[model samples]
Target: MKEALLLQVETYVVDLLNKQLAATNYYHNAIHTRRVVANIEELASLEACTEQETMALKLAAWFHDVGYIYTDQGHEEESVTIAISFLKQQEVPEDLLSLVEQLILATKSEFKPKHKLEAIIKDADCGHIASENFIEISGNLMKEINAKNHKHISEIEWLQQNLVFLKNHSFYSNSAKQLWQPKKEINQLEVQKKIDKLLAKEKKKDKSSRFGRGIETMFRVQLKNHIELSAIADTKANILLSVNAIIISVALSNLIPKLDSPSNLFLVYPTLILMLFSVASVVLSVLSTRPKISNVAITKEMIKEKKTNILFFGNFQKMSLQDFEWGIDYLMENEETLYNSLTKDLYYLGLVLNRKYKLLRITYTVFMFGIIISAAAFIYSYYVYFSV
Candidate 1:
């Protein structure tokens, strides 16, 4: 009689789920409920549960997820209410109906099972975690979440979440632990492997992004340093030019006119020597400050081949504005070409700075020795002429 009643309950619950369950309830459908029913029956038999206990467990499994038809959150309480109402109408004994209601509520994720029956149902509900098709089952659950919540989750993100869940979950009953623990551990390792691979891929992408930024920073800093050094060289050259101009002007105005007199005869050679050194210093200084523009014309072919550096004004000065813009656009589209142009610009700028500093050093040396030699010649000529 009890077996006949159990059969009737199964038919009714299956029909109700098929008719009323939402289409998006992929993880909580009649199929999932049937799996739980089969799992519970196996666990009950393994644990040597009495006939009455087994019947209560089967009833609980069928009604556990039916509450999903009405709501998603706090569905365990709704499931208990639905199960008790249906069992009462079938003239179930009050004690048996109460046990079934408690068993349904025990399936709630937050509820801990208190005894053998509750433990059996709880383990049965999550038996797929140890099943051979765990990955497929997990994927279906993810799809159900996305469909129901109207959101999206990537495969890597889903695997990470599953890894955390697997680490935290454990079977409650001794029979379940013995049967499912080894397979559950294997599933955990599989989830971990997937997560590790995804993380490695993301890390590689991030590293490439950082490398590009680092290259840009290096170019910016080096370019600024080169410009500053060029400015300093130009300023030094200007100082030497002004000092030489003043010396030449004073020599021609004040000393050269006095050289025409016999008394100033000894001063003529020293005055000429001073003027010669001043002219040489002025020439060197001007050479240091002079701008040398490249005469090589940059054609469209050179730009396409990346043979000419469009970043430097001297390289592109002869090109028309339209041509220059086109070259720049091409460089922007190709990262390698753009970096090569920048490198060429920096290298040529370094060469220019080296030439400026070398000429400036020679100019300063000429000016320093010129003053010492001219002064010594004037002192010797004055002493000898006066002593005679």
Candidate 2:
């Protein structure tokens, strides 16, 4: 008969919650009520609660949040009225029904739980806070709050509010406290990680707001200009290298063999001069385009200390995702450090550009001088040898 009554109450509450509760009351719907009942059963076993006490606890859990169907404000009183009506219809004993009412009222967070049964119900009501599903449950709560209250609290603010609530909350029963404390601490760590992420985002947004768009625009434009200039220098150097290589190849293939004959001896110095300049230009061009990278490994501590430039590939290419994320978080948290890293990136890029352009200039000079000097040498040789 007792098991039949519990089942009847469970079915009735599930139907009531499904049919009457607002869709927006996601965290307080049938699922939560069911979880509360399950939790109470677990606690009852651990604490060795009496058969009547267990039945009352389960009934209280079923009817605890039922008042949300009519109104959210002072829902506990409404829940008590509903529970009494249901118990009277079922012909439940007066004392057990009264105890169920007390348990239902004790589930309210603001009310201090007085009796052992009250403590069990209260702890069961918030059991998710110490469960592995805490994170997902918290998200549903946020969505529910947003849906009902129409308030758009930021994630960081929500986390802060939740952390305060958790800090002040405790499981009243020794069984619950012992079983849940470690898991609660784990949930707290998860909350702290979320808070850190939100803080990182806020810091990045604040930095952008403080710096204004003009500073960012200036860096972007200057960096683009530097990259374009480097590209141009590389193209010009490639052209010089190609032209000089062909000239050297033609001079060696067509003129060098002829130099053994006395009649073609005059072309020797001209061919030599052109070949020397062409080879030199090729070497310089290769040097300018050569890639250089540091193979040194960086630690997370270096990134935290702002000693690594996360903007450059060499600094983070070998690092793990966790370490790289930590580096990015550190950079995002500090505007000055982030700006300094960009500055260092730009400075190194400029240095590379300077080196490329300088080498390219020398290559162009050598090619131009080689053309003029080789033409002069050819002209004089033609006059001295072929004019006879």
Candidate 3:
């Protein structure tokens, strides 16, 4: 019966593969069908299966994926329908046809084999999965998967799956295990080697991710703080400027010209003193608030050496935007460089601020003493001019 069913299937398969199948994919074409049919017949011989059992196995194998003629999925149903019709047309017995239909339905990959014949055929269909030809068969499967599903799975996922199947699976017939088990073990090792590789790849990825998150946050926070502080310093400078400007304005409007008259000559010394101090105070105020930018632009070499704050526009405004972005990304990649730039900028800016304050202190000192001395002179001269 196995031999007779073999002949029948071989006959049906030749025509179906040669031309009958629609949207017929090369991956599941005649060669795969033929291979499945051969494996089924071979597995039956080992079981010494009955004629009806053998025919049902062959019939299922041929039509198992016949539904592929219509669509990639649920081809098992199509195979069952095709088998029942074929059996009926051939005047094959009704009982045998029912068994064949059951066998076809059982071939749904997720379904566990329920009968001995079903088990044998199922094992045979997947037999190559554990054999040396596994890679070749897998390629066929990948092609079929891509063609039908329009999805491409990564090599690692496909390898993991094949390893799981071969490791967890077994065939009842002595021939399958004998012929395929050793190869399956080898296949498992190959898959493991790949899995180890993938794991290593993932580790490297995680390391890069951590570095980026940590350094980027640091750069953003520190730069923001520095900018805020600079603004505060500028505000303080502006306040000093306004205060001294008012003092200078008052002195100019009332004191200097009055000293020009000889009658006010008695007022001269004191008034001169007042004018000088007020002028000094105003100069000191201006110096304290003066913006002192570097005379020369910082260069690419300076940035490379980390001798300048390339991330700051004050440092890089002379440079092009393209150069600035490159420098920033570099600073981002090296957290040490970013910190160094910020520290340098802060230290220099602090020095400049200190100088401004020092000058301002002196200016206000001169203005206070001059004002006191000049006012005393004005009073003394007024008494001299009136007493005479």
Model 2 lDDT per residue over 107-155, tens place: 7769898789999998999899998989788888988999899989777
Cα TM-score per model: 0.53, 0.71, 0.48
Please tell me which model should have the higher lDDT, number 1 or number 2: 1
Local distance difference test, per candidate?
0.90, 0.88, 0.72
Counted clashes in each candidate structure: 0, 0, 1
lDDT minimum window of 10 residues, candidate 3: 204-213
Q: Please say which candidate is ahead in lDDT: 1 or 3.
A: 1
Give me the candidate number with maximum lDDT: 1
| Model 1 ranges with Cα > 4 A deviation | 203-388
- Candidate 1 lDDT score at position 65: 89
lDDT of 1: 0.90
lDDT (Cα, tens digit) per residue for candidate 3, span 196-257: 88877777566555556676687567657656665665566566557656766765777556
Best by TM-score: 2
**TM-score ranking, best first:** 2, 1, 3
TM-score of 1: 0.53
